[model samples]
Target: MKKSQALYRSVLIIILCGVGFMYSQSESVYQQVEEAVANSISKGVQVGQEALPIQLETLKGEQVSLDDYLGQPVVVNFFATWCHPCQEEMPIIVEMEKRLKEKGAAFVAVNMTSQESSKDEIAPFLQHYRATFDPLLDKDGEIMKKYQIIGIPTTLVIDENGIIVQRINGGLTFELMEDLVIFRE
Candidate 1:
């Protein structure tokens, strides 16, 4: 009985050590991922750089491309339905859309659906927010990777000349949107 108890204790200690090692490794990995995301966002496309070409399908099944809006300023927003910050910024974007469209500016919301299971929540979410701009779906995350989108609610303001003017990494306020739309360099 004494020998058996010693063996069991040894096994238990080994198992606990293994668990602790795995936990620490997982925490380290998580921190690395966060750092990678931050680095990507910080090093993403800068102002004065030509906007990257984007070819994606809208929710209405229409294909849209960045080239299609070359003659006008464009607001390209990356978001997910499950993101609260993304949701919070939707109304402000919608207002921006309405106000900016009247001035020949295009606002395009791109949904990050690649990591999500289904996009069924999109319609209801848009309806709830009264969003009129047809959102493009980044189903395979190609657009996200192309844009180096490390986080949701990242927005890019592109000028009529196809140069990126501003990049926002968080929820946008109405005043900021207004300023971005009105003050173009």
Candidate 2:
């Protein structure tokens, strides 16, 4: 009877230790996952920072640089032709540009052509949306990487002094676009 009791206690201790080990490992794994998510979420440039340099060719084949518009507010939108949200947001962006350009604000839509199949589609796409403002092509995706663009339809609002005032990750409604560029509060 004494031997049996001792053996039972030993087995119970082993089981408990095994459970504790598993719990510790699971906790470590959870922490690692949490850290990774936080890093990814914080990857993009923040507001109040200076806008990164961008020099690219417009669909019209003209070279444009962000520095050229530093004395006035500039709207830099990163997009791809194939992105549906980008297509949907173009009209709103066009209106926003019209309203803001009167106030001396510049708008540039940087096309992510590196991910696009053919550059031939860009002109037709712009014509379809009646996008009258500058449409720059990021042929090598360098500008997109410089901006840390994680998704399509990302817009950055840079103030006259070249400071980034706002960063938007998704499509913008007309109201939202107006609020961002006009009000900016």
Candidate 3:
């Protein structure tokens, strides 16, 4: 009877240890993923009442700045070819662009530097997706670093005066995007 009790105690201790180890491992993984996503979504115009400065390259290799669009509302979306959420959201963004353009709004996209892709690779992705907007190449990730991008799909809405009014993190549908782009309080 004492031998059986000892054996049962041993099993219980082993099971408890296993449970503890599993919980710790799961927590570690969760934190890693959370940090990664936080890093990607890290780049934004600014946090409340402050606007981020603008200076970035265009797809055609032209230098552009927010000052250039002073009199027009501008939408800047940071996207990557390999990100699944970005791919799913692109069509909706395209439609949003179309509707905004019809309302005289301007929009552009910045393609984050991708080790998994080249400009050649990206061109086809854009073409196949029917994304009509010019996608700037952040090949060196300098802009990404500047923006502090921790994530794939992020957006900034700059008003006519060139002040960034809203920065949306993550993928958004057309209607929600429209609300951000066209409406300004």
Candidate 4:
């Protein structure tokens, strides 16, 4: 009887130790997952996050940087000429250009040149749309990837301090654009 009791106690102690080790391992995994989520939230495209720095040449060949517009509100759009939604968004953007500028905000369009069949399509598209903003050429798609842009017509409405105030994933109306960038207090 005493032997059986000692053996049972030994088994119980082993089981308890195993459970404790498993709990510790699970706690470590949970902390790792928590840290990864926090990092992603800080780095990814989100409203109130600082806009990533962009340096690229315009279709006109002039160089520009997002930093140049640091002290002014800016609208940063990622678009391709082939995208119908981007094409549709052009008119509203064109209409708002002058008005946004008057409100002390600069409009910046980043052309996803890498997605185009030919670089020549850009000039005509801009001309056809009567777009007033000079488009920054993202020739290698690096900027798009950096911004983690999963969709066309992604617009980042950045405030004067360079914090993204809004992230519009698809085409936005003129009134909505005004409400986002112009009419904001």
Candidate 5:
């Protein structure tokens, strides 16, 4: 009986230790996420770097490649229709794109994987929000992962050579993105 009791207590201790280790690892992960988000929110460097080609599925189920826009300045923002910050910035984004139309910039909104939304649901959401820019549906988050996106409303400004000049992690204003996209004086 004594030996059996010792074995049970040892097993219980091992289980508790395992649980504690798991909790610690989880906390570390959260900290890393927070730090990453913080770094993204800070003033982003004008990276002046080229981006690798990545393909995404369009809302119509056709494959779209970023390389297709290689010669133009592309502004890509990752968002969700249900995301309020995303909604709040749509008007600004639309205005920015409109104001800088002659600069050959492409302002694109890539919607996140929304379990509750289909292409049908997205149409009304786009119209209701006055989002003039066509929002591509990231149905499987494959595109999102390509960019290592960890937060909603992340915007990337790719230069004419397919280089990612700016990576803005948070919401951006029309004025701000316009400057990044180089709206002509």
Candidate 6:
């Protein structure tokens, strides 16, 4: 009976130790997420801040406004036709857009029209990437300046209430894209 009691106590200690280790690991993960969110909030346009208004025309000459998407989560991407990183990430962005559409998220691509050599370059770039969504044209780069976009291929995830939730400075991967839109709080 004494030996059995000692074995039970040892097993109990092992289980308690395992639980403590798991809890510590979860706490570490939580801390990392908190830090990442805090850092993202300090960048351009700022997270938790209401998005700057954008009203621009699409390649087909249709006027689109950010206000139009106010009640839905929006993914706003600022890109130029000539940007290499933008070119590489275009397909991934397009795929993410489709995936998030069912959940009522609107994906808006703002082309830095002023940065393009000619308007002609836009069509071929979109065609090559097979991006079916029409991109809004920032004709005078006024929208870009409003958002303080210093880099190409910058993407912002705005929540349903028009607040900027996440701002990505570079190209996106599928996993990051999922985290930004689908899995985020």
RMSD of 5: 16.9
**lDDT of candidate 6 over 1-185, digit per residue (tens):** 99999999999999999999999899899999999876665423778787888898899999999999988889998999889999889889889778778777889999999999998899989898888889999889898888988998999988887888899999998778878854566
lDDT (tens digit, per residue) of candidate 4 on 97-166: 7777787778899999988999899999989988877899999999988998889999888877677888
Q: What's the TM-score of every candidate structure?
A: 0.73, 0.73, 0.67, 0.74, 0.65, 0.74
What are the per-residue Cα lDDT tens digits for candidate 3 across 111-171?
8855346666677888888888777777788777777778879888877765667888889
Clashes of 3: 5
Clashes of each: 0, 0, 5, 0, 0, 0
Q: Give one digit per residue, the lDDT tens place, for model 2 in 34-90.
A: 997655543236687777778898887899998999788888888888999999998
Which candidate, 5 or 6, has the higher lDDT? 6
RMSD of each: 18.1, 12.9, 16.0, 10.1, 16.9, 10.2
lDDT of 1 by residue, 1-185 (tens): 99999999999999999999999899899999999765554323667677878889998999999889998888889999898899888889888888777887888889998966688888888999999878899999998888888888999998787878889988998778767845444
Q: Which parts of model 2 are misplaced by more than 4 Å?
A: 1-44
How would you encode candidate 5's per-residue C-alpha lDDT over 18-135 as one tens digit per residue?
9999998998999999997655543222365556555766665777677778777887778877777777887777777675576666766677865336557777877885767666
Where is model 5 more than 4 Å wrong at Cα? Answer: 1-46, 114-119
- Candidate 2 to truth, TM: 0.73
Pick by lDDT: 3 or 4, better one = 4
Ranking by lDDT: 6, 4, 1, 2, 3, 5
Q: Judge candidate 2 at residue 1 and give its lDDT.
A: 100
Q: Which number leads on lDDT? A: 6
**What is residue 33's positional error in candidate 1, in angstroms?**
43
lDDT of each: 0.85, 0.84, 0.76, 0.86, 0.72, 0.87
Locate the minimum summed-lDDT window of 10 residues in model 6.
Answer: 37-46
